[model samples]
Target: MIDINFGSLFTVELLHSYYKDQLCPDFNILPSNQTVKTLGGHQIIARQYSNQLITGVNCNGKINPPKPFTAIETGAQFTFFMQLNNPLFFNYTNLSSATPGKIYYFTNRNNNVSNGKTFLSSKIAVYNAANTYAPGDLVSNGTGITYRAIGSSKPGNTFNLTNANHWMVVDKNQYLTEADALKWMPSISAYQFASPQASVNISVLGYDNIATTYTQSVFSKTIAFANPASSFPLDLSFLQSGKYSLTVNGIQQWIYINDELSDSKTFAVIDIFNDASPVSCNLIDGSGALINPAPHYSIYFLNRATIWKYILASKQSGNINDTANLYHFANPASVITSLTPIPLSNKALNLKLTLNNHDYSPIACADPQRLVTITKGTDTYPCSEIFLNF
Candidate 1:
């Protein structure tokens, strides 16, 4: 019989919330070193380098701690609870049908403040003899005209086209009935009519590297408003990694799905000016030609340390009066100084330049190292060997 001893065995207890936006109120207090007994009654010391506590059980009793257990792991082995804070109401003000003078009218008579913009009350109802009307109330006269009430009217007073003191014609388009307007109103707010029954169509199309040729229709979803508002998930897990365009109603935006297989290299020329100069440096490409039109690339300074490749500074192309192909860094040192967790002192760094298309697809350079090593004391450097002074 072979007796293999694996040292002491123990369990670690952790109390934490697995919420996505949960914040740590205070630092956790944990034992830096703990003594435990093995199955054979041999004593062993368990230790933790970090004072912070994480969610995991150290069953192997290894000196190095285990990583934090995730919700996916718990869902597979044990019963897990998930709470979704979904949106239950959609504001009718955001609907394309609610443009000014269309389904509703806005007047400065009763102006209010909302989200730093002038808020005008919407008149979205037809003239009703039984309904009491207030100032700035908009109502349709059942024909092809819309009127705004300048003065309060009692419940029994019917709207008259000749009543200039109480009513003013604002729009002559086809009047929208109260029932039509209620279809787009919010379901939970103070101005809610009934559960909004409006629906919207969303379409997604996949594309190739250039985005000029369409690949295929990726997804099409129709969201029907059953209760003022509802939330639905867009499951694109089945899509192959590539560029895609999403269209909601008529508005479209580009999106990229990265499978971690895309190359991130590009060719760039670096020029470092003298200290205390107005502009610290400029970055261009080979052939001494600027990238042109601006903001098509991003530059980053990364420390060359083995353990931690800390980002010393990062800047995007484009500056006022800088329209050429070259990206000018006005003050490179100020960029490093403004970092949240500043970089370490006296560490040698390298510059990484990445170029992208207008749609943000990586434009890989044919020769990655065409820009050679840039040594110190030289007037200009390539993309390597940079040391910044504090």
Candidate 2:
């Protein structure tokens, strides 16, 4: 007798779908077995048995499809055993931590260059009905409202909102009131540091468009991070809507603050795949705290080396313990874990977790039998015996 593992060729979902649709409905035929060579060069014995086709070469007495079978319900619970060839250690490190970086912002406001900084241009003059207006010329009404000429117009053409052929509104009011300042606060949405620093200086500089060669300091402050694993939200709610240059440490960038529109947040994620057991896993941070809302399992198959590839979904958060992280084959044969929705500034957090061995001690045997049990509703299916080297 030969054991054929369909898992080597197809995903659980694909196999289930094929078994449910393509298999011969007649069950009267006697069982037959034949050796077949796959395109990948692996030879397997295929057998027509019962209503399903079984294919695999027996490695010892283990079952052909070593992985867990498909669950009957979405809430099915899967339990699997795992053994490590070597003693497990706390060697997992966090590589997705946020690092020091800078972001830049720009706007459509008119600017003048002087020295190395850009200043708001003051070349806009009050609208003069007797003067010919050219495209791109800025003009203001007596009430501090600004408009730009979109087309060339003679003295007879008026430059105002009513004159759509010649003018378009730029700034309804160039001067911002206290209420406007309270409403529009610009901010640096996110930034990261390579390492914790004692003190970081942040400066916001403003410039005037009237050929001013000096920098107008708007906001300046120094911040210190008590913990490198934490992120800080820099709020510039006090800043009015305008263009300004922001400097963090020595790095400088331009930013345009629009009312509420400039505020933002950043996020990053890490994915973990458990190839050994179907049980849920935990993600422990550097402080030994289980990451709240731990990594959940979802169907992913891009890394599978088999001929069959299909996507499957786990309960959004996996099982009750939230441990159903997806499984994939890695180069060194290990599970991958993921943590997500992390604040971009807190990328320095160190995270770690252990594979299911109760004791960190090494296993002495090879091809150890690992039992996997999956339960759905009242039905409990014990997976076929799997001989795993690790």
Candidate 3:
């Protein structure tokens, strides 16, 4: 003798009210000759299929010629699912004769077998313990709620299915009736579709060389694909021609525009040579480009040889006597070229340039904005200014 289990799970849920458009559960599904339970004067029924009693009442057991499960009273729409297993027999041909009224039904083929193989179906999506679900596969959460799989995983946690990230809700949004949904259907006598649009992929990068990192500075957008190379119409109108180091996406990279102004190797070299005027020098940018003023220019000169090295901004007129107590070199080494200028101001070989507006430049002028610094053997000089003529 063998023991056979004839029990199967079933779910019944009240979906809509008498208005059909509203989803209030003021209707009840009862057993034969069962009285409606009253609570707070207003009638309340099982709205969700998770309600055990209503679902169990809809299950008619494993009896032959299965009895009509439960009948709904009052004006309301309901949906139910029943699983017939074990020594039960159900014929799809005589389904209408057995159950009266407008009945919507489906067969549960999970336990049913044929030719030693189980039937694979997609039409009626039902989630079970035995079945494995793949991405894009539809599954019922047993509460009449259908969810589409986002990844290949066994549906175990029933609570997480309600979250949109794990599963996409399909059957939950049945708020509109069939007639209301069909209202948007277009009536077309004749029509033709245009050609489909093409799609192109793009990647934008921002980098910082100092930090050695690269990140996306601008968002990449899709465009129409073309045969030849094409560029995005971007406007960097606000930025000036200069070297800039910026962090994008937490990455550091050197950004250069106009010229290599932002290059690590780019620097301004002020070469001070032994000349007739000790202030006569050459000012070049990092790229060896000559730095010249537009029209009106002034400068500051610092005396690094002495303890007083701070420079003040001064202007040049027709004479060099604009300021008193200015340092005057008695032995002005005028044509002392082809010699390296030392950074030490105290040293005899140390040649520090002066900032000036005219040919007879100001002595010991240091421009802080230009970041001009005098370098010598193992020493550096920063200066202050005074007006002078060449």
The TM-scores of all predictions, comma-separated, are: 0.19, 0.21, 0.14
TM-score of 3: 0.14
Score residue 300 of candidate 3 by CA lDDT: 10
- lDDT for 362 in candidate 2 is 26
Q: What is the C-alpha lDDT of each candidate?
A: 0.29, 0.32, 0.27
Cα lDDT tens digits for candidate 1, 1-390: 432323222221111111122221212222211111121122223332232112222222222232211111210111011111212101111112222211221112212222222212322456877887654456777663656554557766655546775665654422222222211111112221234336656787863223323456868888776664433444565764334566655556554333221222111111111111111111112222221321111111111111111122334331111123222232223222111111122321232332222222221111211223222231222221222221
Off by over 4 Å in 3: 1-123, 155-160, 172-390
Scored by TM-score, the top model is 2
- Per-residue CA lDDT of model 3 for 155-180, tens digit only, reads 46332465553355544322211111
Residue pairs that clash (backbone atoms under 3 angstroms), model 1? 290-325, 291-325, 292-325
User: Between 2 and 3, whose lDDT is larger?
Assistant: 2
The C-alpha stretches of model 1 lying farther than 4 A from their native spots are: 1-198, 208-211, 214-216, 258-390
Worst 10 residues of 3 by lDDT: 177-186
Estimate the overall C-alpha local distance difference test score of candidate 3: 0.27
Best by lDDT: 2
Q: What is the Cα-based lDDT of residue 249 in candidate 3?
A: 26
lDDT of 3 at 248: 24
